[model samples]
Target: METVMNRIVSPQAWKDLADRLGVDEACLKAVAEVESSGGGFMRPPSQLPKVLFEGHVFHRQTQGRFDASHPELSYPHWDRSKYSGSVAGEWKRLDAACALDRGAAFASASWGAFQIMGFNFAMCGFDDIEAFVAAHKQSAEAQLAAFSSFIRRPGLLDALRNKDWKGFAAAYNGLGFAKNSYDTKLATAYLRFGGRSP
Candidate 1:
């Protein structure tokens, strides 16, 4: 028998977040579509939340101690080559990082729908990285709550409200946003959802 994937974000939750953020519902939906459209979890027995562990974060979290001994799990810079590629593969990387340093491991992964990095647990109003991860694993509602808290930072909320795709993508996705075309994709997704940010 296959274990079911847990998905529990409601339509109202999205609407509330959009309204609370002062952006159009379509703006928020476009973000969700671009970030994690397929829902948040790996199917089956493990049922782990979808994550992309950043080796650079692990390196920073651990202060570069594992750089030599475990270069794959910890690196001084963002190196896309270190990724394992699949959800299951990412879990394996997370597990390996956990073995070396649990806190750093959790801090290194980006979790759930918005791909909120675990290091932002405090910003998202979680007491700890584990709590953040637990909430993300529990349901999409929890993920949205984190996203709502996260986007409220200084310029980020305005980026969404004003439909400043490039600004939002840069702030949210890092300086590397353009490399992935995150801005254009967000614009396309927003338009696909019927435009209008306010």
Candidate 2:
């Protein structure tokens, strides 16, 4: 099935991330399929509080999937209303984030496509949010590298390996939006992508 994600052709980004992380192409592609919906990663350009709030919403959804005691969250909560509200709130902040350009202090702070913190951005050697977005659109490699690092940590891959595209998408996007029969969409996308039966 060819999804908006599968058809995303950020080759430069993919290669940059591959070179840095040494992740296999398939793995990178898979992660990309999850993050950004194969679209250019766009971070909510809001300040720390807003971004943290957004993360909190996503985190809540992520955490709600587990059995409370599960070591790591492997799925999204099934509560449709909860996550839908969260997405609406988050997109508002994201829109605010993007419109920032010498407005409020938090507004100018720079969260890019990957929701990268400014501290991490500095640590990673990026100049600013604009720089990050430009780079992400031009080359997804950095995004891929960062995602590879997040997913490659010991138990993470194991948790993700057993997940189907539906589960995976829920984990990547918030659960509410992800649950709307996305498996069917992914199936169509997979067939279009020439995916074999798993």
Candidate 3:
């Protein structure tokens, strides 16, 4: 898999995503900027996307497959509270989680600038987890494609197209959208990018 350590989308890529989503390019740009600071990579030198691995999700995904006898190969035995919430921590946890179970490991972490959960592979139009990871390794355009797939699955595209920031953010960011002010932030970003704000 090719590691994408830099910004993957060009202006054209954003336009393509907008066209596919049937919304203004600026709205998509706002999402990209707010979700991933305009790209997926966390910073220079790292080819991987910023990720946050949820140990609870890993345990849930692994369930009966976890080998209690060999705690190293089991998600249930893994310490969920040990993460530092940094890039280094993400890599560390990912490496350890992969050692336990590849499928569960990948599914436990949110990927790319959009922070889409790995478990949502099917929702993002992927046939399986491997395909999703492959897409992540491909390019930013691929990442955006996944994002588009995600929003479309939940009918969030209509919200975006209509400039309904609260609706989009509520669905996209979850019920706790107000905690992060995602709706306001997205609206601000949209206006800054020359789009009408809701």
With candidate 3 superimposed using the best TM-score fit, by how many Å does residue 58's alpha carbon deviate from the native? 1.7
Q: Pick the winner on TM-score between candidates 1 and 2.
A: 1
Q: Quick one: ranking by lDDT, best first?
A: 1, 3, 2
Error of 3 at 155 (Å): 2.6
Model 3 misplaced stretches (Cα beyond 4 Å): 1-6, 64-83
TM-score of each: 0.92, 0.40, 0.82
- Stretches of candidate 1 off by over 4 Å are 1-6, 44-46
lDDT for each residue of candidate 1 in 1-198, tens digit (9 for 90 to 100): 222524656778877887777788878878877887736766555667789999999999999999999988888989988999787899899999999999889989989878889999999999998899899888777788988898899789989888899999999988889999999999889988888544
Q: Model 3 reaches what TM-score against the true structure?
A: 0.82
Cα error, candidate 2, residue 180 (Å): 2.7
Per-residue alpha-carbon lDDT of candidate 2 for residues 54-104, written as tens digits (9 for 90 to 100)? 322333434433334431211233333322244336445445433432122
What's the lDDT for all of these models?
Answer: 0.85, 0.41, 0.78
Give me the overall lDDT of model 1: 0.85
Candidate achieving higher TM-score, 1 or 3 = 1
- Which is superior by lDDT, 1 or 2? 1
Query: Total clashes, candidate 3?
Result: 1
